[model samples]
Target: MNSEKLLAILKLQATKNVGDIIAKKLIAATGDVEQVFKESKNTLHKINGIGTHVTDSLFANENLKRAEEELHYIQQKNIGFSYFLEDDYPQNLKHCIDAPILFFKEGNIDLSNQKIISVVGTRNITSYGRDFCNQLIEDLKDYNPIIVSGFAYGVDICAHKAAIKNNLQTTGVLAHGFETIYPKTHKKYISEVHKNGGFITEFWHDEQPMRENFLKRNRIVAGLSKATIIIESAKKGGSLVTADIANSYNRDVFALSGRANDIYSTGCNNLIKNNQAHLLSSADDIVKMLNWDLSKTSPPKQKELFVSLTDIEQKVYDYLQQNGKQLLDVIALNCDIPVYKLSSILIQMELKGVVKPLPGKLFEI
Candidate 1:
């Protein structure tokens, strides 16, 4: 919010390839960033990483003009902006060495909240994945932890929608920028998020949603939250990147287990095997890992039923509950029910609030 400090920092950020490290070094020695800009090349060259290319960039009129234009465009949007050196920037994020000097934010989500959790998973979610994500949202909303997720398909979209449905605040970390929504069909959902929750990115106004941007975006999503839940993921996906970043930040990363042979669950299994993530069998597991105050999390009401059930629904439910997590196909085979019939039955149970869906076609009863 400090315009002078923000503009100064953005000015540094605009210097191509002379990013956080070089900027910090120059700013520290000069005692003020603006002072560094005023100094001659001889003074700039005294710094360890300040070479000829950086010196040229430091004095570039074009870079300075672009920075000013970015600032002007930001103001025109009426969006709230912050600088890392200024007050009201997220304290946790500021601790990172590569923290963005500038952050563009506009929405109702509060970053200063006492507790936050990031939920991420596969875009190709299974029925079980859906139910799993729903239960997490339902349980955590009353406690008011800020839900952070990539606003993509599957679990990310589900997490955001559930939080909004419960009137809870959430934040979506986008790979691109405000210029265009990726997975453009999600425009409606992202639109709702802007009004209710918010969208965030480290990218500039018109940055493309390149394949690599998603990996970089995951760093912010992971860095911003206390913990991350990966409901389902393949051996390779953005969710794995988020988990790795969370670990690097010393945040707890959790991967819910699914079928052993299922490709979608393979990344999660590898995470657990390689010790990047702990297994999250239940919502309580996540709560306990974060050491969150149990009292603040008031789960939704559930009717205790002694109602007798036919052998199939009972079989399916028992399989899920006993294993703590199960995919629909896995459950169907285990319960000896046909896959088609099991689908409808699981849907009914989900509506009844007995089971939860997860990413990568899974369910937990």
Candidate 2:
């Protein structure tokens, strides 16, 4: 984007009481972000939701000054950024109602048609949570998913480490700016994270890691991914808020259940009990829920079609073989397997050439 248009977006972000939603409305009404600034106060006020208070903040001298300072820092440091309207903006985040209009990024980041998922949980991660997070990413490695997390202590860092170990791209969404790293100890992981993936933050260069900033950052974590998984959380925590944001975006959410007495499991259990999230058991849950590619090792072979099958796969194959083509739901019901597991089983059967998938989710032998 041109410098002129970039400055306008920063100024809008720096403006008080003018959030992403209102900024978007203003942009839509004005036809462009640059045009929003060129319009007179009276003209801008005529637009819906752009009242005196917002207009006053929109043109405030101080806001412009801050924007200019941030722009200068960005230019000096050669920072990379993505405006919401740009082609490089995250596809999943673009659909969010309150996603940042502009955000700075650093490191080798790529979002091109990638399978992404955010794994979040309590900072006080338990042995159980850590093991589960590790195994989950290990299993998902075959699918080559990009793991996203806060890069904080406990579950966040655990998720990042697991992803790195699996050689999958990982993104750490920061609460503060690039100028500083929170939890000073994390400074060591920065280089490794950048090499593997990168860091992203909506804050300007010098912004501090305030309490509220973390809350605001959760939206990005939730928005950037196809689904958000909570490994563990207290009854009240930022991860749960992320799950809520993901749900609001009409994205699927999964929560790992734990013993009732475990402190960190409270939030995840509550989410599942309330039907806010799917009950996540193993990696299969996500594999099935997201309908990710099940043939992880190789493409289906063209050999003569004879292959062995598990009892469940046999039931599905026999049903299809006898019944001709059938809808996925019908097969699931007749085979007495839930649609979630049935989907994966069918994919395996297809890879073995025991069944063929047809258009509109139908299957046949």
- The model with the greatest lDDT is 2
Q: How many collisions between residues are there in candidate 2?
A: 0
Steric overlap count per candidate? 15, 0
| Model 1 per-residue lDDT tens digits across residues 1-365 | 45666567778878876877688788888888778788899988988878989989888887778778777878789767666767687777777776666677767757898577888999998767877888777766656678889899988988887777556688998888688788896775655687667987777787889998888788888878888889999999889988988898888899988899988899999999999999988877877777877576676445345645567778877777779888878888888889988887876565445676665788886
Against the true structure, whose TM-score is highest? 2
TM-score of 1: 0.79
Q: State each model's CA lDDT, in order.
A: 0.79, 0.89
**TM-score to true structure, per model:** 0.79, 0.80
Cand. 2 Cα-lDDT:
0.89
